[model samples]
Target: MRTTKHRLAVVTTALLAAVGVVAGPSSGATRPGDPAPPRPVTQNAVSDSFSDTYADPSVIRGKDGWWYTYATSDPLVSGGTPGLMHMARTKDWSSFEYLGTVFSDATRPTWATRTSGLWAPDVRKIGDRYVMYFTVTDSTQHPQGDDSAIGAATAPTPAGPWTATDGPVVPPRAAPGGGWWWTFDPSGFTDVDGQRYLYYGSYFGGIWVTKVADDGLTAVGEPVRVAVDNRYEGAYVVRRDGWYVLMASAANCCAGPSTGYSVFAGRSRSPMGPFVDAEGTSLDTSAVGGTIALTQNGNRFVGVGHHAVVTDSTGADFVVYHGIDRHDPWLAEPFGINRRPMLADRLDWVDGFPRARAGAGPSDTPQPGPTLGSSLGITPEDPAAGGFTGMRVGPRDRLGGATGLVRGTASTRRAAPAGDVHVRLDVRGDKPLRVTLGRAPGVTVTVDPRGRTLGMSTSGAGRPLRDSTALPRTSGWQTLTVRATDGQVRASLSEDDLHDPYAEVTLERDRLRVGSAPVRLSSGGTVVDNVVVTPAAQDARELAPVPQAGALITGEEFDDASTPALTWVRENPQARVEDGQLRWPVEGTDLTGGGNQAGLLLHDAPDDGDWIAQTKVHLDLGSDEIRNYQQAGLVAHATDDDFARLGTVAIWNTRQTEFGREVAAAPDGRTSYGGALVGTAAPTMWLRLAHHRTAEGEHLYRAGTSRDGRTWTWGATWALGAGTEPRIGLYSHGGASPAAVASFDHLRFYRTRWPSDPGAG
Candidate 1:
């Protein structure tokens, strides 16, 4: 499994001042890097003033009958500076008003230095006062290295004049190798028996839970690891229906447009968990099994994770989380910081697991806000325990066996419920099973075991409306689900784990009206049992327009006349531009891991607004060989120790697009390198870096790659220092082997644009 990457904010400031460059518009069009106008809060987003930069959010109901939320330290708007910790509140959970930071410079912890960052606040009302547990990026006790620890602060009210503890609540743990295990993302939970626990840690150290003293200021016992490392982070625990559910975020957060950060879940009987997902797969195993609680649904929001589950006064649960806007990805004007806004959606318990809006994922349209006040202890019924009739049952076998075996050729069973229904059943058959919604002529979804196909047929359709051939054919009973809502129907077949379906299909819309018919299932010699029919929530919302690369600011065609002297800075002067391409032989040298021996051809990057740097490279690092690491593509060079590189590279048997960041590690200024994988690589691929800067001067470069230039997949971001003015460059290095040459067709730069409504264009 590919391990998730953890983000470490670079402490160094930009060494050089930005030099502004202007490019004339082509044909009197808008200037390439002009900042787009502000957009009004319409359908999807929930936050108001703190819309763009509210990250790692936690929501709670306060005594004032209003909902309060806290987030990691970040500037709320462009050109603003980060505060110690951000806070906000709402009367209705949909719209919010910024309540300012938790601490001013005078009130912040004295042990925290100028460079220390207060992150991932976990605020809870413990005892008589509210205590906030936050990750202190650096402390005066360990001033030299990145020794992050948990710190606590007390306040009489949710928004208050807070008081800090003298020392760390949970000190950082030294790693077995060196440095320290990342002690971050703190969350508080109290067991039903009144035992308090604090859960913290990140990718470096798996999430762990430790008993908290009655005062809630110190740990009472040794921490036990709950979720394994490299897979989960940002742990939040909730007790529901005699089970303790652990929800954690996975994948790279803050990769700009490429961020795949998502939320997943596991449940155990105890808060200190040997937690397992719906498949009974352990969360601590190498397989890293997790049931999807929330993920990007190809809407405006992405990088949706690091959440808090809140229950409203009406007893409805809602998941409050942060999501980055794909179209306006950056928080800073033009480009620089990721614009992560807080979002909330109703949560429903299905099959004993919590799903965001019944597996619809993040909403891009307006949703009803949560009610004020504490929940009144309402527990939803488990959807799996539904009523079914007209089924002949034999001796019951509930453990990995058939509950009801069909004896006849085709047996039809009627199920309860009508509108927006979700029907699931465990079935094993040699022939086929058909699940239909509505009346006799309702939409029918067929699962063909022999042909390994999943197809759907509507009322008046001459043929199947949709057919998917990727169904897994196995001997064991497979779980099949059919969801029909909002004039659309979807069907999926999985190995009992509904979260990760093996094959799924979205059927074409027909004249059949949903919610007007009852559920029916028919199968031939198939074992069908554990049938669940429940109402699936309608969450279809208007999505924002997809982002488009704007007009070109500048480019290098690599023609013969394009020399290295005028605009380019040649590092080794070995390569030349000819035949409309820049050709350079692969070198044995590299610029990775504190080494900077490779040659580079650099060009000045624009200092204004958000922009994209792109290059088309054809470098074939043959597969199945021990290529080690051979790469050629784009680089945003600050210095050898402070750069973000995006390239099509070969590592062992796999070829991938690797976005690597080399930065000065904390404590001492030693260089450390880490990477996040983006899209897969083809021999001829186009690489891009969408560059932006935070209000505090941190440079954010989101990586994008394309096998075909027109279609792109963007992923995770790497950061340079706040003040660093990185030059865009190209290089070929890693290994000399087999004497392959890298050919660069052109290097182009384009202005970034926040997408307008789809109908506007």
Candidate 2:
């Protein structure tokens, strides 16, 4: 069963008129200045069929280009037991290479007994050796007590020949609440000052922080309370732009079939906090306001917690965590019997918060990156080697014009490019290689036999071209280049023979197969290799420059920032400039329980009347219990609501059954739509809500969420309402939470009008 974090709640209609059909100069027409439409950030279920009880999974790209993922095993079996640690490696998200338990047969330390369940393992490299930190609980023997402790191990490499220490580095401390406290779930990070800090805690107490000794083992000082009060676990940290961010898992986890885990985060000047939210509110130990970073989707899977933050080779941040397979609920039984393997998603920064691709699951395909060698192919059919293959073509290979060439053969390889790219193939045989590409206007196949004597044809187009001149046949091994460029086919033989090319065809179909001709032939096997295709590089015009230091306002340049300037404000209405510092304004009205509804609005005109528009939003409603129909978002595509005098109210409700069967309210009063919110008051958060129209649909409604405010966490998506011109804004009611004080900032808005006249070269 396939799982996805994103699910469609309603079918949306696209209004072509709103897209670009009707337009005027005075109407802030959709132009280069307008924000781009939201695209699907992450896909799901890369490696689907595994039940490895991996938790707190951390992934790092090795020098060899493979992603090394380390996780805590189940509390049962040889290596699956708690004290034991497990490791797996994958080049792509779809397949994994299990390296087995790393510290199973090692001597049992005094702090870790055979029955102790190991939890939350994090790994990092120092010099040449890999350092691992984890939490172990001897709960089986000490069933009535908490014997959880943080431990350390060393390995020559990520796969490991791990050497476990004799005892816990950070022993269980006395609990503030009285019982023998469990001290486990350790996360390690090196601060900008080159000091190593270990962040750990459990339900027995709140999250604590301590510095690591010079040896990278043992604590140098007493554990300090960084995050307290809430059920915070899985402490992970990363530094960006001088700020140290600490992310932790909150709420009841490991409920197996009914797990309710989500991620939350806070940031501070140093590794230890007083971490604050977007509203500049500190994480209250009594009412911690860790904003929801990401959540689990029932359709995709649940229990998205126990994560670790790692920076990829490209310096991109990613969160690796585990989830209960919604399709296989039984996998969560017997403690560590069937928990799924760990998964990863890219973290993005929207405004200033980290956001995961809303509605995304484990990536189905490995991310396009550096590969080992061009000779070794990376494809779905490859025998589950550790790393990902570029692309492969097999007997069942489908291309345009050709159906199935290598059918019934033992097995063949499907050819793909090095990275996310386009390629072309050169067929030098008498007959064309039968293959199918995507639907029409999809993938194009080109055949260049060097001369007119060679015959080429396309399946979707059904057009044939015959070369008149005879071409040289393959003596030993001649290479032919078949290029698929943006769904257009162009064939080239050698670098020198650039002239008199074979036929050029456009693909009309999606899935094209390559196979033999109607007449059976054997000696004419094509030697296909060097599948060369270049990925369309991002245009400079498309990428905004990275903001300078102390720029004060982010998204001001509007290059890399996804949320428009006005949109940022709608989600954070209270955000405003006060004596140089961004401040959340105290509410004077009861419009939405004192919740200020500031948002980005797209309009056809700078004025209020006579125009169409749309906008995106990010909201933090403060309490999940507050159900003010007014505490929602609004997008006036072509029409504005008379109540709020805005286009539409993309209202967010703790009562919306759309989130799940669970109560939307957190301990505090805040309500969350997609991701989990840590506190009830001043929860730092991110949301993306939009209204648009397309040729196939009218009045589209789209929404997503994120904890970090970078990567988007997708939620119910669809289209609603219709009009030629609409004005949009953020809508908040005055009466929701009795003390409800919602704030918004960083707002941006853009009109949906394409440029009519093309620019000159």
Which tens-of-lDDT digit does each residue in 43-157 have in candidate 1? Answer: 4467744456788888765534456889999887767788788889876655577888999988898877778999999887664467899999888877457988889999877
Off by over 4 Å in 2: 1-43, 47-52, 63-65, 75-83, 139-144, 332-338, 358-679, 682-761
Please estimate how well model 1 matches the true structure, expressed as its whole-model Cα lDDT: 0.67
Please give, for residues 247-356, the per-residue lDDT of candidate 2 as tens digits.
78765565443344777667788778878755454553443455556665323356677776543322234666776554353343342354545666665554445544
For the record, the alpha-carbon RMSD of candidate 2 to the native fold, in angstroms, is 20.2
The top-ranked prediction according to TM-score is 1
Query: How much is 628 displaced in model 2, in angstroms?
Result: 23
Looking at model 1, residue 330 earns an lDDT score of 69
Candidate 2 residue 568 C-alpha distance from true site, Å: 40
lDDT values, one for every candidate = 0.67, 0.43
